[model samples]
Target: MSKKVLVVDDDPDVRSFVVTVLEENQYTPLVACDGVEGLEMIQKEKPDLVILDVLMPRGSGIRLYRHLKTDDALKAVPVIMFTGIALRSFLKSQKALEEFKGEKVPEPDIYLEKPVEPQELVDAIKKKI
Candidate 1:
């Protein structure tokens, strides 16, 4: 069976682009508009990988990413931290510090900037799964 991937982003264009790419690559793409919804899908669908955006409404992607990293069951799922924000911002976010304390959360498997390159995104997904 084709591997499943969950894409969580608030922007419609970005989400659509990713979905199209995943479909073309023969991976099943599951989508969510926000982090909370993404988590729900992750728990229910248990996708092989996740593509997450940093800034979002409801629960932010960083928040959800941290949650997944800390959760025993979901920690192993590969996540690509796709964002328009600079890398330093992500490293400096309050959530980042809070989540990494005690038992540190694992860093995102990959980090992709906004306006993601189609081939690069595909390559990252391929490498992760």
Candidate 2:
């Protein structure tokens, strides 16, 4: 059976794009609109990997990442941080700031910027699985 992938993003366009790409790559793609729904789906679907957005309504991707990272059963699942915030400088500064504030910001297995290339995403998922 093909591996299952969960994509959680607030943007419908991003979800559609990722889903289409995943389907073409022969993977089962599950989607959630926000982090809260994503978490629910994660429990229900138990996807092989997750493609997550950083910002969303209700709950954030970072929140879900933390939950998964801490949960013994789910911590092993790989996550990909897919966001519009892809600047290396910004990510570094954000990490530093969060560290200074004593916040725990765990890095995802892979980080990709918005407008991800289909081949790139598929390759990343294949590598993870």
Clashes of each: 0, 0
The local distance difference test score of model 2 is 0.87
lDDT tens digits, residue span 1-129, model 1 = 999999999999999999999999999999999999999999999999999999999999978988999899999999999999987788777455775675566668898888768999999999999
Which regions of candidate 2 are displaced past 4 Å? 87-106
The TM-scores of all predictions, comma-separated, are 0.93, 0.87
lDDT for 5 (candidate 1): 96
lDDT of each: 0.91, 0.87
TM-score of 2: 0.87
Clashing pairs in 1: none
lDDT of 2 by residue, 75-127 (tens): 99999888888658546755875777676656678988877778998888988
